[model samples]
Target: GYILFGPADSLTLFSGLLVLMLAPEFFQPLRLLAQHYHDRAAALGAAAELLDRLEDLPDKAVQKHENVRNADPGAGIVLDQVSAGFKPGQPVFSELFLTLESGSVTALTGPSGGGKSTLLHLLAGFLKPDQGEVRIFGLAPGEVRFGWLGQQPFLVHGTWADNLRLTTPDASDVAIETALRQLGLGGLIDERPEGINSPVSESGAGLSGGQGRRLSLARILVANYDLILMDEPTAGLDPDSEVYVIEALHKLAVQGKTLVFSTHQPALLTLADHILSVSGRGQVLDTSRGGGHYE
Candidate 1:
């Protein structure tokens, strides 16, 4: 049964001429646990105290000194002669070039491991290219503020509203409700004995995969950024939820917000204004090369 813990194990041989011999190795662990009971209890008490303090403390949010106006002239993203790869001898992407305008939806697609996520990470200013440049407007990648949603999103230990309000501090209750309703989370929130005030466990253990995905999407929706980049946005979604997400994305695109997302879903692909197809071998083939960059 210990094998269920994982692949690591150790076996010892104990032979007896008379017939049977079995070492009571298991009892050793129990004896040690008993000896350490007080210490463990103390540690647990300390942890409980620390968590109580954390709950009491104001969520330690970053100070919002600057205002986010509705009509801010955001910078455009430019990938100028960008080339990235793991090794000098072999490059996953080469001489890659694309520009994401201030208001458009760009869809990136390709076979598995085609460097789609890597490219997005590059554009998001996380990874530096081995060669060439990725610029956000006139500034380097770091100069701009963008909201990115990866395949898996991390949730905060609070109510669902906390996750949704990450982008706009002043987002109204009505606005949040509308977003959640569109994504089918309003009922779940209401059914919760806690309602919006319900305490969400750490990492959202109380939520299912679909619930987590919706919550993650809500977090992105609440945030109003110059550019929104989503990787595999609808991969784990159910059919109805996927439709809602696609509708929301389309609405955002129509609102003049820029979006760049990678997806394997056919419906998501159909929503794309432009597609960046990556070959299985790891190269970006842009159909928008004729001054018709990714949608």
Candidate 2:
């Protein structure tokens, strides 16, 4: 049997134990709040950086002068003394005078970071040059009807059909199937029991790199733009896939769409109607006509 301690003594011991049991509960909310605050700070920093980037973007012309109707009737691209760069005095290419005829294929090739992509961006109206002018279809670059295939094509999470439909929402089933077959993606659809409904994850998780590139090309076909600008169109593709994509691109060119692409692949370069070898200073070091071997 335990001896009875004094009431004051027992009360003191009980209070100490109670305090120890409640200490964690007291600080748990504070610890959680601190972690949340840290996350918020990180998010704020990222947002601020993004805002700075947005602020740096060149402003689009507000006037309606950049419309297709204001341009020449014929479709082609012309760059006159165009100079561009992300930073001041450090241009990717300077004083470029390029002319791409309608219904022709032109390839631009150079060492990495040599401004091939920057030229495409200038043509695509994503970036404005610090000097000179760009004309597409006889109008400003923004007025041109065009499709751009970037180094990495983005595929949203959805079915294959859904992704294609994003290019042309009212595209018919036959048209969609036709575009897939043209891009050599018919086999992908055939393999899937779900067919066009086969699920595609973000950035095309289930598709191989070549398949994704082909799929992106097919999406371009559905959109049916006048000019198709591609950056490293066949990069990371297997030999067979590259050949197939090249063939598809040839067909597109034959269909009268102007094609401009940047590539290091000899095979792809061979497909060009004209090849411009870019120099470190962003000037065309050499220009060669395509052998038209595939034709």
Assess every candidate by TM-score: 0.71, 0.76
- lDDT against the true structure, each candidate: 0.72, 0.81
lDDT, candidate 2, 153-247, per-residue tens = 77889988888888689988888889888888888899999888899998688789888888878888998887899999988889878888899
lDDT of 2 at 86: 82
lDDT of 2: 0.81
Q: Which ten residues in a row have the lowest lDDT in candidate 2?
A: 286-295
Task: Give the per-residue Cα lDDT of candidate 1 at 16.
Answer: 38
Model 1 poorest 10 in a row by lDDT: 61-70
Model 2 misplaced regions, further than 4 Å: 1-66, 69-75, 289-295
Winning model by lDDT: 2
TM-score computed on alpha carbons, candidate 2: 0.76
Model number with the top TM-score: 2
